[model samples]
Target: MSEFADQYLCAFRQTPAETELHQAAKRYVSEAEAYDRTVCTGPISKDGILPATPRELALVNRNAHALLTRIADAHSHLFSRGELLREISRVDRLGAPA
Candidate 1:
């Protein structure tokens, strides 16, 4: 497994009841890495412009998206309104609203 996949698996290991979520996360990471490799090795035209991505890459992306969505839905409770607002505020470097 790739380092990113291992990291995702480790994150999901926090919840023992989330065995399926862990597997889904691993699959998503694997698929995402495969897509990255495919894009990086894709053929280029004579003019140095990269050609269109293959259909396989699209399918890989869709699979990764589905797996990630399933994992997110299963863990949606972790992202409460307060937590989300805090995260947004942190990213925007602004204090939480009064």
Candidate 2:
């Protein structure tokens, strides 16, 4: 296993179970670790996000984007209106998201 995956897989151990973004984080971490495992276990990437193929990269992007959406939905209350708007625009989620 790459040390890259091991690092994040070990970092969020104390997140409360099934709450807010923790839910998506669970799935994201699982998928990331699985992807990391598919590669030859060798020198870990410095960026910790080296995908072996285009499809695998897409999967990672999708999961990460969804996780961020869940994070925004769960904590929108914590953000000021301008902050929320900026984030939404930054992620290109301004044009009718559900």
Candidate 3:
């Protein structure tokens, strides 16, 4: 989450906009999206191993919960910005908050 915030801030800093910690907010939402895309996708079958089963699904859910908790703690009000708001609209259009 902190890294997300840092990256968002960096992006804003690239421009001349004075984001004023709003970058942190954008970062949080971006992190959520990234996690959803990268980690939430079920694992692929490996070698002769099968894809993730129900047990693996449960574990993935648990780990995702923990990771989100940690991210929220680290980024507090990371979604308190216009950029994040726009992202919310974009994501909501796609479906859930993600």
Candidate 4:
């Protein structure tokens, strides 16, 4: 189970302009969509830059988890049960958290 994501940052309402999470989510979605549209859907290249190795991928995963954990810790009071449940469901679909 995703213990980290179960308590990851899902909301941020500090000052009147709490858009960090929203912007991060937007950027993530945009980049992912671009990856899908350009990388996955585009022509394949055998000699192009190869995908990240397992070790590299693991490093990235760990870094992301650490960053999210910090954000969640800093903004713990902003999170809600509903948001956390949604995060749990989302992370559960991915097998486990990093």
Runs of candidate 1 with Cα error greater than 4 angstroms are 1-31, 34-53, 80-98
Residue 74 alpha-carbon offset, candidate 3, angstroms: 1.0
Ranking by TM-score: 2, 4, 3, 1
For candidate 3, lDDT tens digit of each residue in 1-97? 5987877665423332324234433454455545444544454332112224576556546654665455445544543334445544454355432
Total clashes, candidate 4?
0
Instruction: Tell me, by TM-score, which candidate is best.
Output: 2
Report the alpha-carbon TM-score of model 1 versus the true structure. Answer: 0.33
With a 3 Å backbone cut-off (N, CA, C), the pairs that clash in candidate 4 are none
What TM-score against the true fold does each predicted structure earn? Answer: 0.33, 0.40, 0.34, 0.37
Give the worst 10-residue stretch by lDDT in candidate 2: 89-98
Clashing pairs in 1: none
Which model is ahead, 3 or 4, in terms of TM-score? 4
Model 3 spans > 4 angstroms off: 1-51, 80-98
Backbone clashes counted, model 1: 0
Count of backbone collisions in candidate 3: 1
Query: TM-score for model 3?
Result: 0.34
1-98 per-residue lDDT for model 1 (tens digits):
99988776654234543343344444444455555555544555432223255765576557656655665676566543343334433533432233
Q: How many clashes in each candidate?
A: 0, 0, 1, 0
- Compare candidates 2 and 3 on TM-score and give the better one: 2
Better of 2 and 3 by lDDT: 2
Q: What's the lDDT for candidate 2? A: 0.50
Model 2 lDDT per residue over 1-98, tens place: 69988776664454332243343344445554565556534445643547667776677677656655655576665543344435444333322222
